[model samples]
Target chain A: MVGVIFKHTLRHSWLQALYWGLGLGLMALLVVLVLPLMDYNKMAELIQNLPPFVRAAVGVGDDLEYAFSTEGMIAVGFFGKLALIFAVYPAVMGMRVIANEEDAGILDVVLTLPVRRWQVVLERFLAYLATLFIIAALVFLGLWAGAQLTGQALDLSKLAVSALNLLPTLTLVLVFTVFAGALFGRRTVALTAVTLFVVGSFALETVGGMAKGSAAEGLRSLSFFAYFDALGVMRSGLAAANVAVLVGAAAALLAAGLWAFQRRDVGV
Target chain B: MVQSDPIIQTENLTKVYTSRRSQTRALDRLNLSVQPGEIFGYLGPNGAGKTTTIRLLLDLIRPTAGRARIFGLDAQAHAVEIHRRVGFLPGELSLWRSLTGLQVIRHIANVRGMRDLRCAHQLAERLQLDLSKRVRDYSSGNRRKLGLVIAMMHEPELLILDEPTNGLDPLMQQEFNQMMREVRAEGRTVFLSSHVLGEVQAICDRVGILREGELRAVERVERLTHVDFRWVEMRFREDVPAAWRERLGDISGVSEVSIDGTTLRVRLQGDFDPLLRAVSGGYIRDLRVKEPTLEEIFLTFYDGDGKRAAQPERVKELA
Candidate 1:
């Protein structure tokens, strides 16, 4: 039954998956190809001369030396900036899993089938996860292809790690949206809550990273974006604790969503 | 003959919708039974708990105070198992508008773990539904046809349909009636809800009347339609005399007697023989006696204080 719902959802959303995947992938490819033509030293120096708040607002957290490196250029320029835009896809898809269907009254028809409510929630989430995987894979392919085309000696493993690092943070955002939809059963409420969470979390992480040793710096731990660490993933490798926290949080939210969905009256 | 177990049964099923400002009791202690191999018509006006009862039976909404059972299994606990053997058409049918009707069928079939779509195609053909068109492109009537096809395609042991013929044309409605009859003939059961009395009178074996969240009556269709009340209209050869009005009113089982110029109208409840004899005494140019329509019979249930028909025994006697 889960496979049935999963397959059905995938069939309906394949075109959307392709659109987001290709659009983001092409953007990554273009950014990689264009970065080699720009003067990294001049760009880094100009940004370093800005006020701390201004640089922090742009997500450059007092790391001017790393920002001049090739890895930092791709991480901060492409992945870090595009992460927020990519988060919206999962947020909207998460709401579509339950809230939109209930609003349109399709959930009534769906619940009449011989599928359990839990299966509906779990399968749709898995379907979204599958799409997220495809998007990440396409992004990696774009970066790898750009590296090859530009003849840049970029480490393929680090580039792959950077793309892989996007999954857990985005998954956390997706499940949070799903949780909101299940608990509220209203699209406007779910979208509004998720928008606040995503935008507020990003703002907190950016501002907190700039104000090191200050009270605001402690608030970074409260944001899902704190675990993203795109530059760290590009410079080093994947961080086990970061991935654990992110994936674990996503699992908790998915379970909460499933519980709420099972108990509520659909299409009420 | 011994009575078989009910295909669908409810025991004091109730539902109350509550919000911050108010609470509306949608269904009030409804105890209903539907037998196998019979077409049970649940008739009611709008907001009469007909849809609420159906939703409870399908486990789309939980009851506030009681339980419903289908095929001897609890509706909520065993919903998935029951759903496998039940086909449903909701009052307001909604579908994924981006997909063609054929795609909807395919998806539903896949969900039910059925590989064959021959039955769905046959049903669509019988309904004159075009399966190639997207749902967004279809008219309301065509959407209804699609809904009917979806409900009947699986050939389940029981069917629960709410307002199944709302947007259908007369021809399509006739087809649906025939299809329901075929299902009953195959020893399956149908529980359909509708406010349209003519269709219920045409096909249902038993009818249940609901009003204001209460089940007012459950009686055989023949028994409900066989009430003695009727309307008698007469056109005399000349203007009705003042004395003739007194004479007609003097007849037993006659009420609401009135004379308008050359026409006389009266409501007769019993013993038409006295009415015929009295009319024969007059110079009658024309006489029309009409048995009250099912609509009129149902109106009797709805008329007066709303609480008047709460007792099923009284409703039976009223019928």
Candidate 2:
């Protein structure tokens, strides 16, 4: 038989997946469309006029001329800042996978089935990952379509690599949210913890960029944002080490979540 | 014939909840055994640990001490295998609001690897539940019916039902009792927990009464019925003298005596020989006796002077 829990979880998430995918896609398309209207030289001059601290905090890199390139424009606008919107989808879904069901009294019925507790967590996590992947794919398609419509000669390989790289970053956040849910077993607490972590990491990364020292660099390394490397990936190719680190962290979080969930009482 | 092995067994099963400020024991060393092909009623008031025990048996929650076994297999170690042969209906039933009743049933059946849905459809028909309606639109009673259908559809070796008839109408309750009887006829075991005494009394062959986290008594239903008391009212043709009133009060196994003009009301327990003799001397115009409600009988077990309330001969107390 088709895994009943997996099938039901997918059915439960299809509409949500569609909404996030289309919404993120539209946002990416809109950001990319604005790129063709700007004058590269004038935009570079305007960015240079801004305060040094403001420029640093906003992640304006040394290669100002690259900002005019299709890859650069899409990276700075869509992947750097706009991808935060897509992060919310996976975070909320990860928390809902178990904690929300337990709160709503649905998990009591589910756990009584012949399936093991770990199976419940693993299946739901898989379903959530699939949805996140769909959203990311749609965003990539949107970037490609926008480049074609704007008549920009964007590097298709760079665009694909950059888009796929976002998954590991988002996956790390998603698994952390799942870990919080399993540990707390309360939606509000888990949600609050995840939101604080995401926001705090972004703030730390931004401040670390503006600061000048090894201390700041050390703090930045702690944030998942530092390793995202959307711009770097676009300029060069994919970095195997960054992907490995992200995938490894996500795997660790997933294992911890499963262990915690199995040992604790559910629907309490 | 019933199977010799116990279908469900708990050896000193216990559960404790510990917080920073306090610790509460929800179940205290409860040892219970239910035979195959028998309907075992777990009777208790709210918060009497009925749901706790049921959850432990299903392996939904870990026991703080001791363990539970089903079909001679450890509940925690062999949960999947045990669950395969058992169907459970939680006391507070909840479902996916988005799916129709039929879809919910089909999803559970699929999980159990059941290919035939004929039994599910038949159960829905008998319970008068509209499987096409979304679960969000279902009334509380309809939700209960849906739960029953899901639990009974597969005809498992054991059924663990917690407050199965809650929110059900009297007609539906009757149907549920009949369905339970049919389950028993198939040689299946049912572990039913409920606070409603009459329902348990009507259907259960034997019952375990719980109070304050302890199993107070386990006895045959018929034996319990005999221990219940009755209310008696008598009408005299004229105002009786104080001596006659004293005579009625002196009767054995009688209490709560009161007089209103020519009518006297009193509670009668056990034998009636002394009461009949006491009233034979008076010019009795009429007499009426009323059976005590189940609640009254329940209170008799927990009321003041607990030692006097518990009838040693009928109630078998666990150590």
Candidate 3:
């Protein structure tokens, strides 16, 4: 079923998948390929002159005070932030792949068939997952190539585990959009779901951080995106709990989408 | 006796479209039935709820009232099951621009769990359609042909075609009628919706005339042929005198009587023999007899000022 969906998508060039790969690929190339070769001493001097707020914002390494080695500069400068944006492209692109079908009146033709509506929804969601894999593979290869070029003591095992780490989490955003797509039957609903998801996540984090018990930490539990502790994945080599959270959320959201798809009247 | 159950049946079906400012009762308490192994003609003017009824049967839109059953199953609850055995051609042909005719058939076949590809090729050949080109580039007739092939390729038990012959040429229409006859011969049901009388009259076994969301008549094509109006034109040695008009007005069978110089053309209501004798009784002159075509019969129902038969209270409220 997933194969049929993937083949159907390729019948038309869903350019969003290509753009998603290139956008994340370019950012990875700039960080892993370029930053590791920059002057570490000069970066250290620049970090000293930078503002205190900017300095303390998101520290990726323990040695942010001095940019000493090529690996250290690359790690602190670009490593953690790249994954956040990488995860986002799949969600946004997934919306287009699913929502555009309804806007194009393709669903009218598709619904005429003997297949159930959820079959269409689930198949398209599986196609989006394939796109995520392709994009993730490109990013992984880029990272491996950069590590080989610099001869740094980069943990290939950790990176391999990290690559596996992104599969379900990235897929969650796509599934979430699919769930919302079923509810509204419009492209804007998918867009609105993505926006509200991002905004609500940050809002939960902010309110959690402001006061009280592990309430903020517990609220962080609500966001699938927040489970991606890059520092843990990068330094310790794996985050199994984070990956489970990603997989669980994705499955639940996709199940909701399938259920809603089966129940809602199409072409409304 | 139960074998007479129609393949498709609608019992007082209704659909209401409510927007912010206004509400349109698209289908209002309508009743109809379509039996198996025949071409059933569904005729109505524009905005007369024909399309809405099709949508409800297909589960594209929900009816506000009443029930519609296809193959003796609930129209909405058993949509997928019903769709599996039925093929539909929507009145508006909107296909994916990028897909070719071959691709369209393949996709529909795939979803329906069908494996017959060669049959689709054969249908395209019969319809005179070039299946290699993209749908966006296909002409109107070719586009309609694509839909026809898709609807027929599955070899389903029922075919629900809306305005099925919109873009076909005269020869193609004859071919289409032949194909419809073949389908009926195979003991399959075809529910065809169209406003053209001759087109429907040529193929349909029975027809339902819908006006203002109400069915005015549902009778066999044989009865329509029997009831078709005929015209009687007689030439007088002189102009029709005032006395002739007074004498002709008394006949119950003559619907309309008109005078053109020495030629007298009369529109017959039903049987022409009664009307013929009445007109030629006293007027000792030359007489010409002609058959009134279907178009003239249609005009009688659709009047100039939106007036129609003063029947069916539901029709009046809808009108």
Candidate 4:
């Protein structure tokens, strides 16, 4: 009973999961392979010439020393902007899990079974978590393989830490979309709302990085993207507190989804 | 017959849906019961609360007031336990299009904790459904057949079906009726809702007629059709006089008397004693009595100015 809905959801989503994992993994591999071709001294000089606001907005380090490092290149090039593409998988899946079924009138059949409504929502969420885990593992393995082929000094532990760090941030988008679906019970409404929220958060994070003083700090604290420190994880290992925040936020969103789903009438 | 406890009961069950603009009472203060080992037909027109009552019985939606029970257990509180023994086929059947019919059946069986799929295979065979084809390729009738198989596979104690024969062909409808008879033979209860008066008349032991969110009548099928008015035409050897027509019209349970040459046509209700006495005269050459169809009987509750509709005298009042 624990995995009844999980198995059904996985059966429907395994192909999409594979496509996303391969796409993200391939991007990571290409970024890692192209890292060594650039001249660090010349790149650092060029970066240093930019204004401080531009540097902060683009997530360039103050000294430009780590700009040419394998960890730094992968973090900024692969994990930062490109990782946003992975959010689409969870977002689409989260909306489909409940809202699509309800809109199609299939939830009436599913809920009439002996299983409780919470079990259906929770199991589908767990399936999405499993999917995110697989995608992260693929990215980590791709980076490891790229490092092996190029004979670079890429630390496998650092790559693993940085790749795995994407989970909590991606999960925040996933659970938020799920919550919207459970609360609204309409696919179009959930998709529109979640897309707007994710895009706004990304915009806020980018602008907040450029702002000065407490303004920048406050805006960064408000954005979910700020908790995902891929560069920091590569350089100084995993940030336990930041991971905890993302995990805590995701947990709360999932709980809220289950609560809303249980209390509301399905297939309305 | 020995009396037993009701398998399904609703106590003033009501559902009022409130949108931002308006409020609609889908089901209003309905009190009904279905005894064990009987096929109870819930007959109503479209939007007449037939589906609403079924949904409430399964706890698919919350009631605005009152409560529903199955086997003495509250439907909302013990939904899971009640569902374990109740098989439900929703009016609008929607399935996972990606899975084959067999796959869908297997998934439901597993979820219901039934390990063996022999019953499902048997049902599919009887329904003439191809289990290997994906549901997306299935026609509406095929999808309905698949829904029926999924609902009946576990041999539940109670079957709640909403328009079960909606998309089936005539031949398939006969088979469905036969299947229901078999379920009753096994002593399981069935609650079926449909707007087709003939279908309900064919198989139901008793019926509850609903109109505009209210229960209009609940009566045994025999009693319902028995009390309905019949069309009677009498032909005499000689021309009938106006006085005889007036005499027949004056009978307690007869109305709409018309006389033409040697023939007279009239509608008769209640006991035929007075009409029989009138027809016993020697001038009558032929007398024909036509029993009204179930549809005609049902229309007595509908298609009226509300006040002129004739009510069934034997129908039990809602509790």
The candidate with the higher DockQ, 2 or 3, is 2
Summarize candidate 4's per-residue lDDT along B1-319 as a digit string, tens digits: 3457788989999999888999999999999988889999998789999998988888878899999999889999999999899999999999989899998988888788889999999999999999999999999999999999989999999999999999999999999999999999999999999988768877888899888898877878776656558899989898877887778878898898998989988988888778878877647788899876655776665454323255655454334
Of candidate 1 chain A, the 10-residue stretch with the lowest lDDT total is A56-65
Write the residue-wise lDDT of candidate 2 on A1-268 in tens digits: 3367788788889788888888888888887898878787887798888876677666766667775576787888778876567679889889877878888877888788788888888888888888878888888888888888888788888888888888998899889999998988899988998998888888777888777565875798777787786677788877888888889989998999999998888877
TM-score, candidate number 2: 0.90
Between prediction 2 and prediction 4, the one with superior TM-score is: 2
The residue pairs that clash in candidate 1, if any, are none
Ranking of predictions according to DockQ = 1, 2, 4, 3
Residues B98-170 of candidate 3: C-alpha lDDT, one tens digit per residue: 8888887887777667787888899999988998899999998999999899888988899989999999999
Question: Model-by-model lDDT, in order?
Answer: 0.86, 0.84, 0.71, 0.84
Fnat of every candidate, listed in order:
0.79, 0.77, 0.39, 0.77
Candidate 1 whole-model C-alpha lDDT, 0 to 1: 0.86
In candidate 3, which residue pairs clash? Answer: A208-A216
What TM-score would candidate 4 get against the native? 0.86
In the range B164-274, model 2's lDDT, one tens digit per residue, is 999999998999999999889899999999988778877888888787677767777776666547998988998755666677777777888888888888899878778
What TM-score against the true fold does each predicted structure earn? 0.89, 0.90, 0.76, 0.86
Tens-digit lDDT string for candidate 1 (B15-44):
999999999999999888888898999988
Clashes of 4: 0
Give candidate 2's root-mean-square deviation (CA, Å): 3.7
Model 3: residues with Cα > 4 Å off, grouped in runs: A1-23, A39-93, A96-98, A150-152, A195-224, B1-3, B17-24, B63-65, B210-217, B221-319
